[model samples]
Target: MVKAETVDKAYEIAKERYAEVGVDTEAAMKRLETVPLSLHCWQGDDIHGFLNPEQELTGGIAVTGDYPGVARTPDELTSDLHEALSLIPGKHRVALHMIYAVAKDGKKKDFNDIKPEDFDYWIDWAKKEGIGLDNNGTFFSHPNVKDNMTVASPDKNIRDYWIQHGKLTREVSNYIGEQLGQTCYNNFWVPDGFKDNPIDKLTPRERMLASLDEIEAKDYPEANEQDSFEGKLFGAPGIESFTVGSHEFYQYYAITRQKLWTIDAGHFHPTEDVSDKFASYFPFTKKDLFMHVSRPVRWDSDHTVIVDDALLRITRSLVRDNLLDRTHIGLDFFDATINRVAAWVVGARATQKSLLQAMLAPIDQLKQSEYNADFTTRLIETEELKSMPFGAVWDKFCQDHNVPVGFDWMDNIHQYEKDVQFKRN
Candidate 1:
């Protein structure tokens, strides 16, 4: 581990370098503290939620590893989350799926009949942790998923059941937000599609639109509850041909309905840059944006995020456009091939690092160069900025936040695995 004195000395020198380019490192770090990432809870248990431990993961979703020590209960998942959160800098929120709800009475409840009280255990835990919560309605991996569709299903019984599930999720999300005193973003993403090219594609989308309209008809306090919709390019084999909620579909829906729209990094085509989409939407929408940051390798593999070019571009776009305040950032990847807790720490920290790098950039200077048509200076300065002492500033940020600097946090993960995770037989 690097000594505190060395970290401080390096930060001082790095701070001077950044100042030369008209950037305030201190202000950047301070701004970073205000941005809270909503870490997804599905990573803790591979999306095998507590409601149905034996239920096969259907609806075109699949987790590819058999890593041991997966959290089998709500308690274990939260404990693991606590450990992961300690190593990450700044305050963050936990995003939970409705399927993870706990019953204090030890009785199973029907999906449509679920109440806000069912999530009291999680709300109570969040109170103690002093962090806010976010929510998503579990539309997949349930018995009601007929013909691989939920709200868009032709069966009225199945469609109504899922629509009611969506409505109740809004209530539960509102309760969570009220308790935690933060706006809970209730995101909707359904696995409703067909494997082959359907001749009646128009019918499913029409049904989906009507179902969503009914779900959003009930009013909730805007201060506590906000609804968002997520779209996908494709999914696992059976549902790869046609996704009911395509990007165009949700983009239009969110715009017309005045709801937040979510853009998952891994939900688009492999070559499509999600970074560019933000600016395109800002020109028209007045609502806050929601994002699911994930690393997709070749496909939507949901790999553990690393500080790569794609990740950097996404963060840079947000920072350059000055849209951090209006954006809700969240992680949405589950990699069961390695230690789950470690996966959380790695992905979250990678995102934070990317954001810090973006903030440290002299965007004003870069913009001025562009306006003056000084392409030469813009190119040279950007290239040189890459070699600046970014690592030092990052290490300093970690130290200031009381988190482990550099690779030292790995020691905690290893020890936790031996003492806490490995012993989970």
Candidate 2:
């Protein structure tokens, strides 16, 4: 256990070091509080939403490992989420898929038939927890998906079914936002693609656009609900050839339609630096951006995030360019190999740590050095900042937030597993 006094002393020393570089530790911590990460609900249950837990996870989504104690009900999922949130510093929103809706009064609803009332339980829970909610339309793992398509399917019936689901999802999202007094981001992503190189790729994309247009026809106030479109590079086995909604597709769609564009870190090529794309979009994007932070190994593996170089670059890009206000950060990884609650705590804290490190950087000095063409100073100072007492600042931040400092949180997770998760079976 790390003593609070030791944490305070280390923070004081770290504060003075950062002061030498003209950085305000207090202000950095304060700024971090304003940016909240939207934690994905699917991670708690491995994407097996309550609507149909027996359904196979389709649309190129796959969660490996037989880690016991996965949440099997809405209550279990939320309870696990509460446990995860307790360990993570700062208030954050929970992102829900339409499939997670809780039925009421012995009533059940499918994706297309579910109403906002179906999500009342989640809304009430969020209200009590003082957190916000985000939502997504479930486009896969349902009977309507034909030939690996939903909205872009050649079958109008299949397309219309999903279109209705999309519309209802937006309604539910808007309701949740209004109920919670926070803006709900409703994101749309489909697994419409072909296994073999389709001779007619343009037609599927055209159909997808029309379907999305129909879904967006009924608009809600941006204050209550904002819509986003997520694209992909490739998908599961059958979707390897052609993804109808590629990054290019959504980029144009989002800009032209004035909707938010989602950029999942794993949805791009392994070599691509998603951080670099922010500057490219910030100039012309009239609306805010949404990001799904995940670590992809070789392909879209959705590995648990650590405080690695890619994450650092991403958080640094946002901080250095002052784009935190324009971007909504969210987690998108699901790893069933470890303790589920521990995975959430680790990923969330890693993200928080990266953001803190970025906040602690001497960004002003680095920018001035760049503006003056002092490459030597710019390079050296960036490297020097890496060696500074960043862990102390992070520990202080954790202390201030009343979350565990350092690895002490792991002990709590083990106890929870023994008392709560392990008893699930």
- TM-score of every model versus the real structure: 0.98, 0.98
Q: Please give, for residues 289-406, the per-residue lDDT of candidate 1 as tens digits.
A: 9989999988888998889998999999999999999999999999999999999999999999999999988898899999999999999998998998999999999999999999
lDDT of 2 by residue, 112-223 (tens): 7787988899998998889999999899888888999999999999989988988898999999889888899999989999999889988999999999999999979898
- Give the Cα-based TM-score of candidate 1 against the true structure: 0.98
Where model 2 places Cα greater than 4 Å from the true spot, the runs are none
lDDT of each: 0.92, 0.91
Task: Score candidate 1 by lDDT.
Answer: 0.92
Determine which window of 10 residues in candidate 1 has minimal summed lDDT. 104-113
Clashing pairs in 1: none
lDDT of 2: 0.91
Where is model 2 poorest over a 10-residue stretch in terms of lDDT?
105-114
